[model samples]
Target chain A: MKNKLLFSLITFTTLFIMSCKQDLNDLSNETNNASNVKLVGLGIMEISYDMKTIRDYETDFSILSELDLSSVNPSEEKQHVEMVLLESGQLNLTITELNFDKKINIPHEILPDDSPKIMKTEIIGNTANFYDINGKLLGSENIPIPNHRETVDKIKEIGNKFSAEDINKTIATMQGYQFIDNLEEFIRNAPANGVQVLEQGENYVSLRMSFNKIDPRIQGASVLLIDKSINKMVGTRIYDAQDNLVQSVFFGYNKGDVQSLSAIRIEQQTHLPSGSEVKMISISQIENLKFNLNIK
Target chain B: MKNTIFKLVSFFVLFLFAQNILAQRNVAWVHGLDGDAGSWQHYNAIFDAERNINSLRTSYNTDNGITHASNQVKNSMDTFYGSNANNPLNLGIGHSMGGLMIRDVDRLTPSTNKRFGGYVTVTSPNYGAPIANSLMDGSVQNAAANACNKLNDGPLSEIFSLPYGITANLTTNVLCNKFISNDLVQDMIGTPITNYDLRVGSPTIEALKNHTNNSNIPRISIWAQESSPVHWRMFSSSEFNNDQTLVNYVNDAREIYNVFFMLNTSLAMACGVGGFWFPPCWAASALYTYRATQWYKGRSWIDDSENIWNSLIKTTRSEQQTYWAYIWIPCSYPPSLVEEKNPNPNCGQWEWREFTRWVSVNYPSDGLLPKYTQELQNIPTGNRYYVPGANHLEVRNMSNSTLNGQPNDVTKARFNEIFNRPQGDWFRTN
Candidate 1:
């Protein structure tokens, strides 16, 4: 009877050990799956701009107009923006070295100058961490990530299957058509009869493209000046329904094997109610532009 | 064969009993100011549901100083645990001033092998409570005393026909007792010694700061902020509504009296003009004059009623404003993010910007204590849990609907999370 009891105890001990081993194995597999997720590339750029916004409120009475006139002084600031596109379709942006002419005050005891200068986002965690100028972590916030799981899957699939050029195209598309890439597609997709060559130079061609066919609400057209030699858009002008020049963007490119934007200037004019008009002009200079960077 | 079976069953039972004895855990529930062992009756049931855990509801004199109260708690703990009074596995859970008492108990005891394995403070005023400061300054008590005096001697006395005599004394004794019994008034007039110890910058608080929990014992703080407005009873009571209605009726009576006065004045003037030759006209003028004088006197009485009503309304409104300011604050954002006035043309009539500027400040508090005071700097941020919209009492009661943005059971869940307990094992030993 004692021997039989010993055998039962041995069997129970062995089963418990086996179950524990299975749990350890399962934990390791989960860790391995987590390790497979990686950041594919990162884009680093320094943006410095001096923006002046003047708002003029015109009224029938001169006294009323004078009282309503509100304008913001020209403010100069500089920031370093890093865009990290993960292999899991997670895009994170970190802004550092954010300098302003004056300290900006945010509500609830956190002032912009005292707050963390380096702000970064963790895609998988759906959270953002803020660090001071010396890289000491100050705080973290959980941000809502829409379609998180699906985005991760899509990004992993793209990273695994796409070539370097295709990945660059994807990053550029995500950045928007205004930065770089998709120039051929954009030109091809323009209305057949709406595109008209406005001017032609030795190295550049200016084309006027109307967007009436694409969307009826957009009663506007864009005039793009592209460098014919490099097939890169250098400048663009957008007009409103009343044929008023609303926005103008000028892009400067680096002289390198890979065409990259070095500087950009944007000017915008908006008309508000009460006969108010606002004009803003800003110049952003970018540096350290890299493509297909392997980010850890 | 029967002997073998009986011996095996005895051995199994003994092993299980030994396991239970080894796994025994004790949690002492400490109450705050003016509270007793009964204060934890609700939480006692919660902890009782856990296996191998004993709940010790400590009874102490909360009216005295924190040190004295802590001594009482120590005695109770010693009596309950007996030989294991200084057990390192004992846990302490305190609310409000009881938290300070528990800390005092720890401080008085030897540091090595401390009495508490861990400590959890719920809505404890670590840095002291502002209300305590107000009480110590005699402002809250003065307000209550003044209110009581007014109820005894002011317009209320005249209205009830008890004017400066035995009846007035009787009315004062009865009515003032009722006024003093009001929950708000009673809380404001808390015991002096406890209030002094609970005030900010008190010697006890400074001592606690100096001796902070340097031991390796784990500490957790569970604090809440009261986001909801003050209860209606605090500012607008049924008595106030009735008084306002009385004022409106008095104003209506005054208007009627004024009409009669005007009509009587016109008749007196006509009679006086004809009284130069007629005796009946002279009598008629005299009668009209007397009637007008009486109506004017009645109008003056109505004016007195209006004045009293205005005074009461002013006092109540001031109290309401004070209560409102205590729980809420104006927006503190910069001009760029928020404007002083709405700039939208379509909604120019709306005061949305002004409303936001005045009411949008969601400062964290636990009704009685602010977040800053409730959170102990010694405790790590990870260990401190905040439940927004849960007031001081509601946090411990664990019945606040707005606690952690969930209806009922959230407080228990939060407490379980703080204790690192799995579901259905809040106090169970693994």
Candidate 2:
């Protein structure tokens, strides 16, 4: 049984390796062809965000200061109103209609006769301490209490409305999105000495070109590995100044109709070591670097 | 044998040393809002010489917002440096929301090993942009609809869809929600947003205000001011607004959106306008005029140490007016020949000359973020480099020194200096 499994694994590895090489060779051939194309629509997406502390309202404190603390005994256990500010806001200060004392849990339904008082309450660095009618130390409520029920409900509503599948679908369609209307002009105005054809075959051609200048943290690389076995362009590799492999980027893109004179699609991925990646779908008319050719 | 062994070991040591010298530090470029990795396309050459620069792309899907983006950045750092407690030394350069992303990185992954040598914010609206109000209040959406209709009448219909995708984003009120909800975005809610909203009721902004940065990492801010008088309308020009593209590929609404400073806390304080409402519109406008004409406070970075660095670029409105008059006005005419009443006062109406004066004394900004917004009260200053006449996007272009017919060597060198320094050593005065 072991021998059979080993044999099967070896065979699978060999087949997988062969298929990858065949795909790369085919792509090399396809790009190497001396195809005249114009640079038209290019879509480069930049994804970034800033992190800030998200405040939850549930555990917030409503300051009810100046407790009476005039009657209870020091030894006897007594209850008092302890408020915590879960989130800083204009909290409608409400006290229980009947001030019962084991421990007052903040109610969600605020009554109209509650007489909403106002105070600039803070959740940081300060806490609320409750005492009995007689001066006895009760528990203290700290700032930044867990989010309120209403706040949690709102978050849930937002979460329910948010569909990862919808988002992913939108992003996938945009990944290979193209604008091939003005390919010729973009290529004509591209930086000079930007393209160098490397290899070619009967039906294909491959070329190396400088898309844009990126900073020097990366050095040493030889060629761009373009994997096009799938419908969209996915990953690309960059070498350092010394022609040694250093970075690899995995992304997504849409291909333009290369057969027709109408448009061309190219997928380029730029990788940041910070794990951020950009998959660009550049669709244009014709193809590759604009070489001198007849326009039909 | 002993001598040979010593020589071999010495050779190995020397080789490693040489490799270290040649290897450059890693640079992560966090782009602005609605920006993908391509946003940093212009500044590529700046670090190509010695540093490896990675452009971090943020998600456009508003649902994820900054919270999700922060997680992505942390994951990227972990992946880049390997999952270990030891993080490689790197410099983080963020523009606009990108800077806030860095702050978010620090917030989310406080324990992560990725050590930032230094952080540089170029024209970052650490405080929220007032234009976000116009966007949220439906003014910008209305304008975009108007602009799209106008553009469609011309050749714009052939290339761009009427009410472009970005315009629709603004109109739908989705993209603005992603921003207004973010805590970092909340930090920048100035001007139009009432003081009650900014101070008493805003939980996120209030939390941010009280939150302290315990780390000792150095932060350097590079801001630009218009050398000449720049009209607000000039921001709509192709050079500053659209990157000279045939189609509107990026959202440049923040540039031209009218920012009403009536509710600005500082301006209110300056004008002595009080209360939740009924501050007297004329009084508020007079205060705004005074604030705009006078040398108002600019951006400052205050760390836990209580250290502060004021804006280095300072040119009074009077000085800027004089310079504009000297260049555009005839030698015989008075400098104030064109008063504020004239639409073309200070020659600001002309888009061709507007680029030269993208920032000015009255409106100190890099044609995107205002200079005054950088100068919040009570924040400790770290390091500041001020460059007048520098556009917002071009602030990161270090290489080529001179491009777009402008000399950027001074600002470029300043950027290089901050990046080249070791962690905790940059922007030190003592």
Best by lDDT: 1
DockQ of each: 0.00, 0.01
Candidate 2: residue B277 lDDT (0-100): 12
Error of 1 at B245 (Å): 22
Candidate 2 Cα errors over 4 Å, as ranges: A1-296, B1-24, B41-44, B51-63, B83-89, B111-117, B142-209, B212-216, B226-362, B375-382, B398-406, B419-424, B427-430
* Candidate with best TM-score: 1
Score candidate 2 by lDDT: 0.31
- Model number 2 iRMSD: 32.0
> What C-alpha lDDT, on a 0 to 100 scale, does residue A118 get in candidate 1?
32
Docking class of 2: incorrect
User: How would you encode candidate 1's per-residue C-alpha lDDT over A1-296 as one tens digit per residue?
Assistant: 43343333223222211221122112211111121133333312111112111111122222222111111112233444433433342334344444553331212211011112233222233334445456555444332221122223322433454455645652333232232233333334333434566655555556665544322333556565665455544556666568776555555554545445554445554322123445544444445544332321
Model 1, span B1-430: residue lDDT tens: 9999999999999999988866777788898874577767776687578445777995788777889988888888888988777787788889888888888888778876466766788888887776666555444443334334433322221122323322233234443243334333354365677777877889998787677746556777787654333211112222242112222222333333433333343333333222221212322333333334344334333332211211211111111001110011111111112223644443212121110111011234543566777887866677778765455565555543432334644556666675555555333243
> For model 1 chain A, where is the 10-residue window of minimal lDDT?
A106-115
lDDT per residue for candidate 2 within B329-428, as digits (tens), equals 1111111112235344433111112111111112355544567544333334647767544445545443333334455455666665655555566432
The alpha-carbon lDDT assigned to residue A157 of candidate 2 equals 33
lDDT of 1 at A73: 19
